[model samples]
Target: MSTTGHHAAHKVVVIGGGYAGTLAANRLRTRPDIGVTLVNPRPEFVDRIRLHQFAAGTGQATADYGTLLGDGVRLVVDSAERIDTAARTVRLASGRALGYDYVVYAVGSTCAIPASVPGAAEFAVPIAELEPARRLRARLRELPPDAPITVVGGGLTGVETAAELAGQGRGVTLVCGHTLAPSLSAPGRRSLATWLSRHGVVVLEAAAVNEVRPDAVVFADGVVRASALTIWAAGFGVPRLAAASGLRTDALGRLLTDETLTSVDDDHVVAAGDAAAPSGRPLRMSCYAAGPLGARAADTVLSRIAGTAPAVIDLAFTGSCVSLGRRAGLRQFARKDDTATNVYFDGRMGAMYKELTCKVALWKIRREARRPGSMIWIKGGPRPGQPVADGARDDHGARDARC
Candidate 1:
C-alpha cells in the first residue's frame, strides 16, 4: 500500500491474486490518483491452467509477482478474512485491516474433495489449486513407478490430468461419471477419446465414484477397482468470503453483480473472475473470461470515480482447448455465447493450439502490467438480461472450466 502513498485521492483493495485479480490491480494503475493494493494468500502468481501439468511433473505452475504486477501496485501477502462494506475496510488473516474507497472481489475458484464420499476426503488428492497440486505432485513422487492411478471427472481438467499421467507410462483410469468432455462436440469427444485409448489409459464413462478408499475406488454399482492413487479433478467451488461478507451471490456463491461487474449491494464493491455472477448467468470459469472481467471491473470503478456511467460487459468466447499429453490435444470450437460447435482441431495441431493459448494468456497479463488498459477481448456475448442459450451455462458436477 505504500507504493501509492496514504493520501491518494482514491484507494482500491483487490482481493485474490489470480489472473483476474492481478490484472484488475494493474489496470487500476492507469489513474495515478487511484492507489491500488492487492491482497492475496500467496506471494507468487499461480498459472492455474498449468496445475495439471504441475501435478504430473510436466511443468511449473507459478511465476514471480515481480514479472506480472505493474509498478506502483502494492502487493500484500495476506488473505482477506472479511469485507466490512459499512466501514469500507477489509479484514486480513494477519490481524490487520485495510481501508479502501473501492474493493474488487476477484477471489477465485477452488476444488474440494467431498466429505460425503466415505474416505475420499482422506485418500483423494485434488489438483485445482496450489496447495492441493503441490500435495499431488509430492504424492506422485512418493508412489512406485507402476502404481495404479485413478482420475475422477471427465471435464477438461480430468481429461488433461489422466492423459498427462498416462503419457508418462502410468496406469491411469478416468472415471468419467457420465459423458467424457461434455463440452466438446461428438467428433471432438471422439478425437479425445481415441487419443486416450491409444495411450494405454482406461476410460470408464458410466462409472460414478461412490466411495474412495486408500487402496481402491468403489463405483455406484458396487464394483470395486484397485487404485493406488486417486486424483480428484472434479467440480469447482468458489471461496465463501463474499457470502460471509453478506454480499448478494448466485447459487454457486459467485458475487451477484450487474452487467458492469459492480455489486448489487454497493457500488464501491466490484467483482470479476470466477467469483462474479454478472446478471446471475456467469460466463465459464476460465483464464479466458477472467482477464477481460478484470479489466471491466477496473473500468467500472474508474467510471464511478470520474462520475460517469460505466459500460456494460461485452465479451465473447472463441472456444476451449485441452492438452491430451505434451504431444497431442483437442480444441473445441465454440460460438460467441460459448456453446460448442462441430468444428475443432485435433492431434498435433490441437497440441499447438493448447500450448499457444497458455503462452498467450500469460502474455496478455504481462502486457496489461506494462500497459494499463491496453487489454482487450472479443465482443458480442449474450446481452445483459438476455438468457444464455441451452448448454451455455457453467459446466457443473463434472468439468472444470474449459481451457
Candidate 2:
C-alpha cells in the first residue's frame, strides 16, 4: 500500500465501531500529523449497553458513525480478515489491503452460547447486538398476551430483561445459575432480588440451566414451562480475530494487552473494550470501562506517534447500576480503588438515576463526537465516586431527607 500523493508519514487503522473504536477514532482525528482509518463491518455504532432496553421495548439503539466521526478520519466499512503484524498490513473481508503504522483492535465481544444446550441455538435469543435485540423484541410482542416468559442467566441483563417483560404484564421467571449480580455487594444483590420479586418476576437463584427448549427450560432441579420467547444472557466471549491474526490472545480469544492497552509482544497493535484483556488484572465487560479504555488507547496511539512512550492505562470503576423495569433500579457504589462500597439507591429514584446514567453515557460519546477531547473533565474528579458523586449524593440526600 502506497500513499501515492498523500502524506508520507505514519498511518493508523482502528478496528470496530463500538464505543471504544469510535472514541479512539474521534480522538485520533484531532492530530493532523497521522493518517487514520477506522474499519468496521457496520456503518453505524450501536449502543451495546442499551441493547436490553431496546429488546424490552425502549428507544432506538443505533447511531450513525459518520455523525460521530471527525472530518479527517476515514471510515472503512469492512471486517478485518487478517493482520500481518510482521508486514504491518491488514487484509479486509472486501479483498482490499491496508498498511498501518499503528492498529487499534476494539472489535468488542460476542455471546458465547454453549452447544451442549439443546434447542438453545434454534430458540434462545441473545441480546448482545442491536439486530438480535430488535428481533427478540418483535418476537416477544407476537407472543400471547399472557404467555410465560423465561430469562436465563441472573446477571444484570437477565434481571433487567425479566423486569421489563414483567412490567409489560407478562409472567417472567429469571433463572439464576448461581446468584444475581455476583459482582454486586450482598446488600445490593438482596435489593435486586427484592425488586425483581416486587415487579412480579419469579427469581430462582442457584438454579443452573441444563438445557433450553422451544417451550421450556430444563434446570438442575426441574423444568420450568415457558413460551417461545427464551432469552440467553449467560456470558460474553470475544471474537477470534486476534487469534486468527496470529497475535497473542487468552483462552477466550481476547487479545492480551499491556498496561497501556497495547498488544503484548506487538507494540504496533493495541486493543480496547471487551476484546482486550489487560495484563495481570481482571476488568469486567461494561460500557463504563469501554469509554475510558477507548480514550486511553487513543492517548497511547497519539503519544507513540509523537515519538513518546505511551502513558499507562488505568481504569477505576465508580459504581454499577441495574434497572428493574422502568419503575425500579439499584445503584451499587464502589470505592476509589474499584472495590465494592456499602452504598446504594433503590426504588423509583434509583430507576431514575439508572436512566440518567444511560443517557449520560450516550451523551458523553455524542459530546465527544461533536467536540473531541471534551470528556477529559471526567478524569479530574475522584474516580467518579459512584452514586455519591455530587449530583448523585445530593439526590440520595434529598431522598433520605424526605424519608
Candidate 3:
C-alpha cells in the first residue's frame, strides 16, 4: 500500500488561483493523504502575464479552473477575507469558513499606479487584472481612430501595451520614467527601440509623470502631452490580507517566510507567488519565479508530512521574454540572479521563442494539473548558512513595497 493510503487525509487550503496558487494546489495532489482546497476570487484562471494581450484583444485571459486544477483538489470560488492562523482556518468573503491543516497564501498582485498621482486612480487603466483589461478593451473600442494613446512606464508591461496598440494603428507614446527596458541589454533595447519605431511609438525618456489629467499626462518637469487613453503599467502591488490577519508582513503585507517557504509565525502557514517574501528576500513578481515557488511550497508540505526536513528554496531565473507586438519580441538573457546579460534572442526569432515560452508556461500548469508534481524548476546552488541576498529578491515584493 502507498504511504498515502495509510494516513488520514490532511486538509490543505490554497488561497488565490494565479500561477503559484494553482501550481501549489495541483502539486499537493501528489500525496493521496492530502485533501487540497483552492480558494480563488474568480472561478476561472487568469493568465496575468498575458493581460496586455488580452487588453489588445489578441487573446483571452481566462481558463476554466475545472480543467486546470487537479481532481484531488476542491475549488472554492470566493475571496479570502481573513486567515486565522491560530485555528488554521480561512474566512471567505461569502461567509464560508474553510478548515485546513496547511494554508498556502498566494493572492498574487496588481498594477502599482499610485492614487496620490492626481487623477491617476480615476483616469489611468491598469492591465493587471481581468476587469481592468476588459475596461481598457471597451475604452479602446470607443475611442476614435488616430487618437493619442499614452502608456505610462517603460517596464515590460508598458512596452508591450504600447507596441500592441501601436500595431493596431493608434497613435502611441511610451513615457519611460527613466530609461526604456532598463533591464534589457544594449542590443535588446536597440531591437525593442527599432520595433517601437517601426510601430510608430514615440519614446519619452526621463519623463517622470507627476499627474494624470483626464486627457493628458503632466510630467514632473511641467511637460504635458495629450492622451486619449492612458495605460498604467508602471509597477506591481499586493493585497493586504496578510497584515490584516495579523501575520508578520515586511511592511508591504507580504507574508514573511523562512528559507523553507514556511511562514515565520505559523508552521501551518506557507506562501507562494507574489504574496511571499522568503527570509526578507523575495522572488520576482513575474511567473518566472511564481511557478517554481508554488512547486517548492508543495514540496515543503509533502516533506513535512513524510517526516523528512523540507528542502530550502533555491530559485534561479534564466532570462525574461517580452512580446513587442505579434511580429517582434525580446528574449533578453539574464544571470541566474535575474540581472541582464549581454546575450539575447531578438526580433522574429525572439517572437517565436516567446510564443513557445508562453505555451510552455501554460503547458507546465496544465501538465501538473493532469499529473501533479511533474512540474519542477532549476535548483539553486548549495544552501548557504545565511542564504538571503538583497539584490536577488523577487520583483513582486519590490512592486508591493512601492504600493
Candidate 4:
C-alpha cells in the first residue's frame, strides 16, 4: 500500500495472485528501478492444479506467500474492482485507489457453472476455488460410504476428483458429456478409462446431465440416478472485470492482447494466464502455461523500461501430466503442437511424474523469488513479425465445467 517518490519513479501493479500473477510480480520486483505491488484477495498462494486433491480430503491447496514472493515486492490482500486506463489507476474492493505506471491484469478465472443445466448450480459441489474445495471436502466427509456421489464432466479435473473420491472407498459415478479426455490420444483415453473401471468408477460417456436434483441427477434421456453428493468439475470461465473496465476482451471476458502479451489498446498494461486471449487464441489454463506467460509479461515491462525490444510470446506444449489419484496417473507425451504422441508413462511412475510437476511449479516460483531472472522457460526464437506455430489449440477436455 506504499508508493513513494514522484511520477518518474517506475511502478507496476499486478492484479491477481495466482501462478501467473505471482511469477510476474516476483520477477519484476527484482529490477531495482521498478517497484512491484501484487494485489490478491487471499493471504496464501493456492496451488490450483492440486485443488482436486484438496476436495478429495487428501492434500493441502495453499502455500505461504512469504516463501514465494520477493522481498521488495508489496503484497496487497485486496481484490481489484476496476481499472482506469486513462488515469493509470486501479480501484480496489476496499475503496482504495492505487496509481501505476504499468499494470498486469492476471485476475484469473472462476468456476464455469452451466446455466442451461437446471439444478447444477444449486445441487452440485464446485471445487475450483480454495474455499469451495475446502467446503466440498468437509461435505464429502459427512456423507456415508454408501452414498452415491456423482461427478459431472470428463476433463482432467473431473477424472482426478472421481479417482480420489473412489480411492477413499466412496461410491462414485462419472458422467462425461462426451468421450473422456478428448484432448488425449486414443491410447491415453483407453488407459484412463481402464484404470477408472478397475477402481469401481462407473463411466458414463455422452450421458449429458440435464438437471441436478436434491438427491439425484436427471440425464438428457430422462433417466435419473441417485446422487447424494454431486461434484461439478466441468470447466472454468474468466471473470468479467476486464470487460466491465472497458478493456478490449473476447467473448469469454479474457483481455485481448497481441503476440507480445501487451494490451492492444494500452501499452501501460500487459496480461497473462487464463485471463488473457492472445491473438484471440488463449493457451490452456494450466500452471504450466501460466509460468511462462507470467515470465513473458514481466519481461515485457522490463524491456519497455530498458528501451530494448521485448521478446514475442512463443510457447509449445510438450505433454500433459495428469494425476488419476494418489496411487496412479497418466502422462500423455505430445509434440510441440500438443498432439498426443505414442509415448506415455502410466501407473505409479505416472503418478510420481505428476507429483513432481506440481512440486516443480512451486519450486520454480521460489527459485525465481530468490534468484530473480533465474527461470529458464523454453522459448521459440521466432523472428519479429513471424507467426510462430503454437501448439495445437484444440481441446475436448471440459465443455461442461464452468462457474
Q: Residue 382: error of model 2 in Å?
A: 14
After best superposition, candidate 2 residue 219: deviation in angstroms? Answer: 1.4
lDDT (Cα, tens digit) per residue for candidate 1, span 185-255 = 88888998999999988999867788999999999899999999998887778999998999999998999
Q: Residue 316: error of model 2 in Å?
A: 1.5
List runs of model 4 lying over 4 Å from the truth: 1-8, 381-403
The CA lDDT of each predicted structure is 0.86, 0.74, 0.79, 0.81
- Give candidate 2's TM-score: 0.89
lDDT of 2 by residue, 1-403 (tens): 1123136377888898887788887777567677778888987778776677788776567877756777667888899998889999999999999999999899888776778888787889987777788889899778886788888776777777788788778888887777666656789888887777776888777787777888888876676666567888776678898989999898778888887898896998988877877673435667777778788888888888787998766555576787777778888887645456778888898889888877777677777767777755234323222222222211011111000
Task: Give, for candidate 3, the lowest lDDT window spanning 10 residues.
Answer: 394-403
Tens-digit lDDT track of model 3 for 5-66: 11347888899998889989889888777878888888789877677888888877788887
Worst 10 residues of 4 by lDDT: 394-403
Candidate 3 global lDDT: 0.79
Q: Of the pair 1 and 3, which is ahead by lDDT?
A: 1
Question: Would you list the rank order by TM-score, best first?
Answer: 1, 4, 3, 2
Candidate 1: the clashing residue pairs are: none
Best by TM-score: 1
